[model samples]
Target: MAKKKTTQDPALAQNRKARFNYAIEDTLEAGVVLTGTEIKSVRAGQITIGDGFVTINGGQAILTNVHIAPYENGNQFNVDPLRNRVLLLHKKQIVRLAVEAKEAGVTIVPLKVYLKHGFAKVLLGIGRGKKQYDKRQSIKKRDQERDLNRRFKN
Candidate 1:
């Protein structure tokens, strides 16, 4: 049988610092609710998930602090760039995330934004804040790995 073609969506924005700041324990994909202008801006790759985070309130998941630049042609229709947007997730999933988020030092952070099947989605990560010592250890381990790779390639 001929294999069906599968194409992954292109990433619009990513929070590169999240990995260095937190230890992610789990991840899930969630749909984003966006305005017309916001969607246009996201498709144009004018979005930033760096400071964005997810919160579960009243049994709903909401994404906050993400910046989606206004569409050049949107003019008066453009909404606030940092407005909180709703994230679509199952009731069970929302409850689970809420429980996890309630734990001390645990948070729901947006790792990346992308378009999938014509809809915008956010990669939500369940993470625990890393200590300063953990960050230093991670950096040191990464450097050692790089050095080992270089030595082996020679």
Candidate 2:
């Protein structure tokens, strides 16, 4: 039998700062463990991953600071808006990430959240924190680019 074609788009929520504040070295896609209400909220686009960070705890990868707002009709069954959600990754990947995170100034952060075939997913990136000078350079470069674009339009 021929394989079925899929029309699913692979994106949900994006953390814009993840690209600006860090030099991302590697990225990995992973599944997120969510409660029923949380899933409902995400499907309705009521999720925020801006301040979230990833950590390996007790041999498992987990996400912290992600906020999924409660469904308006869901009172008793709603999930906590700021709970730490678990991430699903392989053991080898977890070990590698743990070792890499121990290196100076390296950390794990969630870059985006998206859906794949109706399942919620998140993009995790291993990044090195940018120094103050680096951030300033990026800002200067962005400003120059904007000016160049404006000049071209005139």
Candidate 3:
């Protein structure tokens, strides 16, 4: 009797530029409330979070600018791709995020979207926009690391 092994699902979509443009101080995982067609599109890897941001309003966390492409076979069931979607989070967590987001230069950015236990989840980052000079420093550090790795390989 061998034990079964469960495979982890990779992110359906990611915001690659979030780290480059923002200095993330904290991160949170949140469940997404998606309709049937939207979920199908997400599971098919037809989702994008490049420009997504999270905002709290009326005690609810909303995901905006994330796009879940319409399912090919969904037809009428497919809803608007850019519609604001609710994020499932505890009231206390929402309150904390909202408070943190109100700080000057601080905002919530969507980092990644993945599926776990048949539910879609988003990884959100609490970050501040990086200054132009800071971005240059990040690039310099990355280039130095790449050069070091190349030197070691050859």
Candidate 3 Cα deviation (angstroms), residue 137? 0.3
Evaluated with TM-score, which candidate comes out highest?
A: 3
Tens-digit lDDT track of model 3 for 1-154? 9978665488889898999999999999999999999999999999989989999989999999988899999988999999999999999999999999999999899999999989999999999999999999999999999999999999
Measured on C-alpha atoms, candidate 3 has an lDDT of 0.95
Model 2 residue pairs with clashes: 12-114
Let me know the TM-score candidate 1 reaches against the reference structure: 0.94
Q: What is the number of backbone collisions in each predicted candidate, taken in the order shown?
A: 0, 1, 0
Q: Write model 2 residue lDDT over 64-143, tens digit each, in one string.
A: 99989998888999968998888889999989989998899998999988888888988899999998899999999999
Worst 10 residues of 3 by lDDT: 3-12
Q: What does the lDDT come to for candidate 2?
A: 0.89
Ranking by lDDT: 3, 1, 2
What is the lDDT of every predicted structure here? 0.92, 0.89, 0.95
Can you tell me which runs of candidate 2 are displaced by over 4 Å?
Answer: 1-10
Error of 1 at 82 (Å): 0.4
Best candidate according to lDDT: 3
